[model samples]
Target: MAEQLTGLAGDRVLLGRTSTAERVSDILRSRISEGYFPPGTRLSEDSIGGALGVSRNTLREAFRLLTHERLLIHELNRGVFVRVLTVEDVEDIYRTRSLVECAVVRGLGEPPYPLQGLAAAVAEGERAAVDSDWKALGTANIHFHRELVALAGSERTDELMRSVFAELRLAFHVVDDPRRLHEPYLTRNRELLHTLQAGDRRGAERLLDTYLADSLERVVEVYRRRVGEDGTGAS
Candidate 1:
């Protein structure tokens, strides 16, 4: 952990002029989303604070914020660790995504649609696939969904979904086979993108809704098998 932090040392602090806690939280959030802080990894205050050149108090505040967002959990005596999401969490996340993403596609704005973001994200996934970068492909998949939600033209909703995607990354980190989990989605995402690009709005909504449902089922099956009913990962 200290070595990891050392690499981040001397980097510009995020969101300049923000409060210390907020800035620390943003960096930590980005790290977690990037899969640097994998699920169940213990975060030592001394190590993290020393690495980031911040005080323990500030680090604790940042941890508290992430915990509130369900990205980390503090045990009574063992200290804070990245949260290990259960199968139930996966189901709920997909449910929320299905509702919100499907809604965005259904009510997408009229012609001259704001699709540059979506197109960029799709292109990113394609490049990742060409390089066989499974982890990056997964990240690009999340970006596509984020842009899809942006179609609704709601900053508040986009912010909410951002947190949702971060939590979703936790599940991704625990995946036993990255290719098995993300490869199929690469093609599906491209197909979905084309549907919208061709102005098949209705077809796009149905595809997205079905896509979320199928994804939820696949993730739940794999997750349950990997983690078991009580959330203790298979040993």
Candidate 2:
């Protein structure tokens, strides 16, 4: 099967009429998530295109798309580099995640919405963490929240969280240890599920808010330390 993207566009079936820009954007996004193009790393149009086996035009298009997302930033007279998110950016992301996600869980109470999917996602996160699969864990965590937002009963809401989740994946690049960053939250997630199962929607919402803030701080702390070492990184 072909790969997928979690955006307004969703999973794209590669077909006869797929645009080069879209394909290249998808490929480049995957590479960035896989720890290829890290923060502050410049992209040369021709070079990356040649390496990825795409044309320069396609690569440029991909770069522009990512730039629009704030994942990539352009410098005048220079090339594009992947963004190193600031603590402010981290807080902003958390704020948005909390707003969208907590609101999602607030509406879900006991025995109503099927939470089996979220439970499975939590398990997948743990298994992925144990396997030293940070990438998979990251994806699972995003899926968990994305599904949480799905409870808001709106596709538009789901799409909004999906974009944030994608940027969250990109932010994971600078993380030193995925286990330290995410594994501890598995229990809290389980507990929150139990609370929701018990019809404690308010408690679940509070737990989710705390979880988002704490998790955001953990990663931001790591990001800050790294940026300190480099001196020109995340502010």
Candidate 3:
């Protein structure tokens, strides 16, 4: 875990004048989404503050912000730790994703739909697959979905989906085989992209619905196997 957090070093650059706490929160949040800080790992104030060059108070505020986002949690005696998502959390995430993502595709009101973001994401996913970088592949998958939601042309919905994908990454952190978790989706992402580009909105929506449902079922099964019936794994 220390090594994972270490990779986050130099990834943060403080702007000329910015909210320190919020910047720290954004850095930490990006790390969490990238699987640098895996689920249930305790966050040390001294270590993080020292690493990121932020004061303890700022770090604490950042922790509080992440806690509110459901990415971190505070225990009574123990310090803050990354939130460990459950099977139910997995279900809820997919539920929300299906509604939002499919709608974005299904509700295209104009002939000229934006494909730049989606195309770029799909291309990145293909590149990640070629390199066999499952972790990068996972991040690319999240980006693909974010681009999908961006199709709706609403900042609020995009913000909401960003949080949704962040929470989904929590569950993804426990994946024993990242390749198995993300590789299969690469082709499907391309397929959905093509379907939309071909002007088959209804077909694209159906593919997305099935894609999300299959992914949810697979993720839930793997999560159950990892955490067991009582939600305890080799953490």
Tens digits of lDDT, candidate 1, 1-235: 9988877774545433237987898899989999999988999999999999988778888999889889999999999999888888888889889888998888876655778888898899889989999999999999999999999989989988988999999989878888888889878888888888888888999998888888888788878888765457963
Ten contiguous residues with the weakest lDDT in model 1:
9-18
| Ranking of all candidate structures by their TM-score, best first | 1, 3, 2
Q: After superposing candidate 3, which stretches have Cα over 4 Å from the reference?
A: 1-18
State every prediction's TM-score relative to the real structure. 0.89, 0.79, 0.88
Q: Residue 188 in model 1: shift from native, Å?
A: 1.4
Off by over 4 Å in 1: 1-18
Worst 10 residues of 3 by lDDT: 9-18
Question: Quick one: ranking by lDDT, best first?
Answer: 3, 1, 2
Residue 130 accuracy (lDDT) in model 3: 91
Largest lDDT belongs to which candidate?
3
For model 3, residues 76-158, the per-residue Cα lDDT tens digits are 89999999887887898999999899888888975567888989998999899899888889889999999989989999998
Judged by lDDT relative to the true structure, which candidate is superior, 2 or 3? 3
Top TM-score hit: 1
Query: Model 1 scores what on Cα lDDT?
Result: 0.87
Clashes of 3: 0
